[model samples]
Target: MKIVATPIQGVYLVETTPFQDERGSFYRAFCDRELDSLLQGETICQVNVSRTEAVGAIRGLHFQYPPHAEMKLIRCLKGRVWDVAVDLRQDSSTFLKCYQAELSADNAYMMVIPQGCAHGFQVLEAGSELLYLHTAYYEPKSEGGIRYSDPKLNISWPLKVTDVSTRDSSHPLLSEDFRGVVL
Candidate 1:
């Protein structure tokens, strides 16, 4: 496995080489030794799976406030998605900047999203499944989200965006005074 940094400081693109044969393939999804330094002693505390049924469905742009803030390692387990992360760390050079990649089961790539960043994805294939490893547990009171279509971020999703949950679409646009989250 190899970890490559993206434009955003804490965000990373994790690459894995899967051994393929006539019958199947196998690869290490996570190796603590290779990733421990980046994790900074934090351990994954929760694991979640999401399945999006529509080809153009959008699932988030979500994060949590400090105290419940999470670091996510996400990968497409089945099908494909246009994964995205937005840097929302206060005083960071790349605040509000976007980093995106096409994650697919075939590629075996994962996106490492640190705390203070918003995460979301657009389903590129129907029935796309994503597995997430998080360093923090979910907290309703600390939950936060920004509109996927927020003009301030202007995310260029790969598809027509055929489906979106009411909760996600309801997130307010970034305000002029929005300073950013401090991790």
Candidate 2:
């Protein structure tokens, strides 16, 4: 696997080396040794999957606060999506900066979003499935999100948004008073 760093300090785009044969293809999705060395001991404790049934579905801009902050390894399992990560670490040099990548089953690429970043994705194809390996489980009390269409972020979404959860739609915009605290 190859890990490509993003503009944000701890974020990366991981590409797997696939071994193709007559039967099918094989690839190592994750290796504890390799990841432990790279991340210096970040431990993944949970795995989650999200299956979106419609094109243009938007599902985040989400992150958890201190004590429940999560580092995520994400990939598209069945279809395609425009995945995004926004730096929200207040003390980091790249705070507020954003990175985007196209994730599809065909490319077999995954994105690593560090604890201080907010992650989101827009489905580019119907029936897209996203798989995530996280360092922490969900904590509703510590969960927070910014609006997907926040003007300050100006995310260039690839498709016209067709659906969003009511809770996601009601997420507050990030404002000066709401600066995130770095962990």
Task: Give the Cα error of residue 132 in candidate 1, in Å.
Answer: 0.3
lDDT of 2 by residue, 136-155 (tens): 99999999898999988999
Q: What is the TM-score (0 to 1) of candidate 2?
A: 0.96
**TM-score for each predicted model, relative to the true structure:** 0.99, 0.96
Candidate 1 lDDT over 111-149, as tens digits, reads: 999999999999999899999999999999999999999
Q: State each model's CA lDDT, in order.
A: 0.95, 0.89
By summed lDDT, the worst window of 10 consecutive residues in model 1 runs over 29-38
Which stretches of candidate 2 lie above 4 Å from their native place?
A: none
Which ranges of candidate 1 are over 4 A from the true structure? none
Pairs of colliding residues, candidate 1: none
